[model samples]
Target: MAGTDKQQDMLAEGPAIILVEPQLGENIGMVARAMANFGLGELRLVSPRDGWPNEKARAAASRADHVIDAAVMFDDTAGAIADLNFVYATTARPRDNFKPVRGPVEAAGELRTRFAAGQKTGILFGRERWGLTNEEVALADEIVTFPVNPAFASLNIAQAVLLMSYEWMKTGDQAVRPVESRPEPAAKQHVESLVAYLDRVLDERGYFRTEAKKPKMIENLRTLVTRPGFTVEELAVLRGVLTSLEKFSPRKPRGSGAPDAG
Candidate 1:
């Protein structure tokens, strides 16, 4: 049910499925099957080998006849996709000048985010045997790729589309900014407290009295502690560091020549 919201928003932009020059009726039917599984409709066929909307294709599609019924035939790939605002070219390997390669999930996430931000997008999948030509792929706004074991990463076109759809459904509209992930604020606070406790111990041991700029030194120390945005684990680490420093400090308690355990 986690992906239900996504599943329902399935067609936020009424995205179209553009199959550029499918080779077989079975593949078209399979494509239809894949689209139906993910609640995607609007099949745009750019020519075919066995003639589309046929019984063979229908048989392959099975319950996904809605896609077959409404399948729009096109004379060319551009004709099929001319109405789309954004296009994603699905490819397994890089070609035609280095472009940013997005994994299925990542591409879906981005497309969904863009759709939520009001962009009509479509995915451009090529023929199975030869994949998309450089000319066809060049028409796309971005390139989407899948991660697989390099030795055996050949994914069927329908499968590739389904995976991308699954990821897009999961993405929703959260435009998460990529940052140098920091620990939680609460954890950061705990680290700050640990550092404070350390300062108090060092001060009580007269390490600061010997130094004229004690306040400036502690202020600088505070700056370093506050910026980490620490997590619980990070705070624990700060505590460990303080404990180690305390054990190794030159000063000691009145009876043991060790820092006070206070």
Candidate 2:
């Protein structure tokens, strides 16, 4: 499903669960069920091999309606996590990349600290068969691995999600973290709308004429827009600017009477 509905119906202010290239709908459903079992709400899917809105996933989710209903899909790992300030990659094997490695309990503790400090956090789970690639793990700020028996390090996607979910729930509400008095960050949907609007305007002006460069340009725009915790007022102001630009004089040219060229 689209992410707009998920943004509106966000349940708990817990860390997001991002599934990258999940293979089976049943696994997706089970992951959602696990997240719901512990109060985790946001679930993001990055390029699931089997498309979304899967009946198998829904049936597997069973009574965990909230998690399944609010699940959102993305095209890539970077886009899936663009809105999150902090992310943890969950894996079983060791990689050559240089990153802070933490066990589940330690990572959970760190997540709590970050949450208390008002940061959007997420946990990245790789595919069911081979797990996360170095490139995907590199995207995360830290690597989270379980202390499993070396002989059998493979962990099911759903099982890994449940363990992290359980730890996230373990941090009791009593944790005294200062709540920010400022306005809550604008929802991802609203931010996306603003970006899309700007993109449309740019497109009409032939700003993306170079077909080969358009993707990178768009990526840069999205990154620039979503990196900040923009407030509602800020978003409104930006959209207003775009609207004004769109209506700006297209007839008059500079000193010479040359019509505005595309």
Candidate 3:
């Protein structure tokens, strides 16, 4: 099964991810995957080089089909964000414009605040190479940039989307599911019983070789067994393993045993 829960509806209502003249279908698909990772689902494309409904994008998106299937295409940058009340244009290079600039984190927080106020917001991402032109940046209400190495600051189209998507999600309150199911903790009696059984077996095997060290060794053994606070199921498995080891015995080689008789 896919990592997503089909039972729950996708979060398709956050700020739009607008890509201007995106070049690759794979990058578009990957951008969808990244958006899905963080719960933002709206995707807007402006004049994609390979055109819309690209199969290469679908394959690259992994199982994030909802984002790809719901993507909206536009003829130009202006049309892509026409309905949005606020928009942010992302750029790596410093522009000569006077618009307010924000880092990814601050932009995400602002998006959350604006969204709460019932304002529609969107972020504009430029081409895979060269990014948004100065005129395109002017269309946005504010500029958002990344704090990257000044010497080399260019980012992949999908990578830029992922960073912004992640920041947007981080600003929201979402619960993370636990990795594994946890059973009830073992009862105190169950823990003591296992410890007692192991102590008996070890004593029989002469594991506590010296009387002076025996008490400390037993104490250490008890501590080790009790430290983990094993679940009920785990305790049962341990007891079963101990029982099997106690009953096991090595058999003599068949040929050696029957050599004299032969």
Candidate 4:
């Protein structure tokens, strides 16, 4: 009973953990255990790969019955997060459209602060086989990505959730607070503005005005620019790039730097 109450408190403090179409019962149960590790317990399963209420999952949950007992099953992702005021989709790859992204630590800190501020947040995790679909990603207000080794960046579902849960656990621990190790997303307005500026720079470069296969190339370029979940710092770097181009581009004729006559 005490454990159950503790789990409930954790949920009250932490954001809802949403697993999108998880593939196995064991993984589902493992996720519960991971949540428990960070004092988190509420679990929302959306279109699970293996049907829920399986003994297999129970076995994986082990002593985390409190987590399993409260696990909610949903037929759709939207249904699972319907009551959530904020949603963040976790992915290893990126979307075609520019989406706000933050490091899990930054995201977790933001969530903890927001939860205390009276807003409900949801963290969405995708399937073990495949991550969230483009359609699913569109539903989120934010995105979270880990700084994993590029050679092997594919993180499994439970592992991914664990990292997120761990981050959220450090709400007040100043020693463990976010440092240079992690970066948060740039605001929507900032990203949009930077993108517009980049388009202008690229235009000046004639990157988009070429005649051969220009249409396809521009489409691809736009997608690439829009995909990364850029943080304000990243956006600043790019903006610097734009400033540099604007200063030098549209190059004057040869000997353009000649001193002006008195």
C-alpha lDDT score of every prediction, in listed order: 0.67, 0.77, 0.77, 0.73
Query: For candidate 2, lDDT tens digit of each residue in 36-118?
Result: 88878898999989898788999999877777888899999878887776778898866655567899988987788777777
Query: Which scores better on TM-score, 1 or 4?
Result: 4
Q: For model 1, what is the C-alpha lDDT against the true structure? A: 0.67
Residue-by-residue lDDT tens digits, candidate 1, 1-262: 7665664454333457788888888878888887777767777888886676678788889877767887888888766665555567888787643345677777776666555545456788888887897656655656787788899989887787778756765665466434334222432235445657867776766656434556555544544554343445666777788788777777743324333222
For the record, the alpha-carbon RMSD of candidate 3 to the native fold, in angstroms, is 25.7
- Worst lDDT 10-window in candidate 1: 180-189
What are the C-alpha RMSDs, in order, of all predicted structures? 20.8, 9.2, 25.7, 11.0
Error of 2 at 11 (Å): 1.7
Better of 2 and 4 by lDDT: 2
1-262 per-residue lDDT for model 3 (tens digits): 5534641345545799999999999999999999999988889999999998999999999988889888999998867876676678899965655667899999998788766655677899999878998767766667899999989888999999999999988988743334244333444456556777876776665566555655555555544564454656788999899889878733333222221211
* TM-score, structure 3 vs. true: 0.63
TM-score computed on alpha carbons, candidate 2: 0.65
Quote the lDDT for 215 in model 1: 52
Q: Model 3: clashing residue pairs?
A: none
**Candidate 3 overall lDDT versus native:** 0.77
What is the RMSD, in Å, between candidate 1 and the native fold over all Cα? 20.8
lDDT over C-alpha atoms for residue 36 of model 1: 77
Q: How do all the candidates rank in terms of TM-score, highest first?
A: 4, 2, 3, 1
TM-score, candidate number 4: 0.65
